[model samples]
Target: MKTFLFRSIIGIFFGAFLAVLFTNAIVIFEGRETLDGALFIKNSIGSILCGWFSAVSPLYFEIPSLKLSQQTALHFVTLFILYFLLAFGIGWIPFTWNSFFITVLIFIVFYLIIWTCFYLYFRQQAKKLNAELTNLQR
Candidate 1:
């Protein structure tokens, strides 16, 4: 419970930071001076929720009965839905089929990149641990 709360708080802050950075970039690119207060608040909340879920979703993997693939699928779908809704709601993407397709493609690419990185890292760690165990058994 403590760890969960800690991660949630971390996620909230991360979300807020990303929201600010994203908003700034968009403003600069569009030559905007400022954003509407209500819009800013809405975006901030959305980002926070996304971040919170991103952090907490990994807990799904702790279920011993679930295969790795199942956990991964659930995590992917949950995040995708949350992000798609948020992006569409915030007008970051248009309500068109083409836009949705492109967004999904981009999301999948990024998700794969991240997932692969983590997989390789953990594989490496497992190898190191196995090597250590072999040495100890000698």
Candidate 2:
């Protein structure tokens, strides 16, 4: 558990650095004229990557489980909650949509995309790790 936690922390740190670097690059290349475009893209990507890391960390680095599916489900749930909270927090954009419905729709779509990617990636990793463990046991 300790080792997994350590490695997961390292992964999150690395992921965060990558997010910042990518966001900076976008701002430099895309010019400051389009604040909304740049900020939207940067925020979406950063949040997705953050969600992915948070979701996968438990499965890849932290917990050992008797059933791989169980672990994956737990991780997925955690990621979903984290992403929802993030999306909700940012849902009320300072000056965008006039109606709350449109705002929520946008937020939900963004959250779905990020969550889907996180789920797929976590599933792949869990499968690979479980296979490796099986081989080791054999």
Candidate 3:
């Protein structure tokens, strides 16, 4: 129960972080502007959703004694397919392949960063939890 709670909290945090980072980057680099309140809300939701999705994936999902090489390969393949499909899908939406491709590229990079940060944060938390468990056991 405690582990589940911890994971949930981590997922939420990662989601918020990802949303804000991407929204801000878009504003700065793409010269895009959105209404303050709406933008904030949208970004917050987006980040959380993406964060949750990533956390749920096997790559980011927590598991003990997982084989690093296999996990990494799996992550790479999944992400590659996901990004490609997403980009193509977005292009299909508006019939704008070039624009969608560029957007996907940007999103991919940002998502990668967010994933790394969340993963590290969860890892550290897990380490702390393990230590506490060990101490309690001792």
Best by lDDT: 1
State the weakest 10-residue window (summed lDDT) of model 2.
91-100
lDDT of each candidate versus the true structure: 0.90, 0.63, 0.65
Clash count, predicted structure 2: 0
- Taking all chains together, each candidate's TM-score versus the true structure is 0.87, 0.45, 0.42
Instruction: Kindly list the per-residue Cα lDDT of model 2 for residues 26-129, writing each as its tens digit.
Output: 77998755556765665755555564566355653345643666765666566656655565566524434455467567756775687578779989999999
TM-score of 2: 0.45
Cα-based lDDT at residue 108, candidate 2 = 64
Clashing pairs in 3: 15-47
Model 3 spans with C-alpha error above 4 angstroms: 1-56, 59-66, 90-101
lDDT tens digits, residue span 1-138, model 1:
987899899899999999999999989899999779998998889889888988888887778999989989998998899888888988878999998999899999999999889889999999999999999999
Residue 136, model 3, lDDT: 100
Candidate 1 segments whose C-alpha is farther than 4 A from its true place: 24-32
Q: Give the Å shift of residue 108 in candidate 2.
A: 13
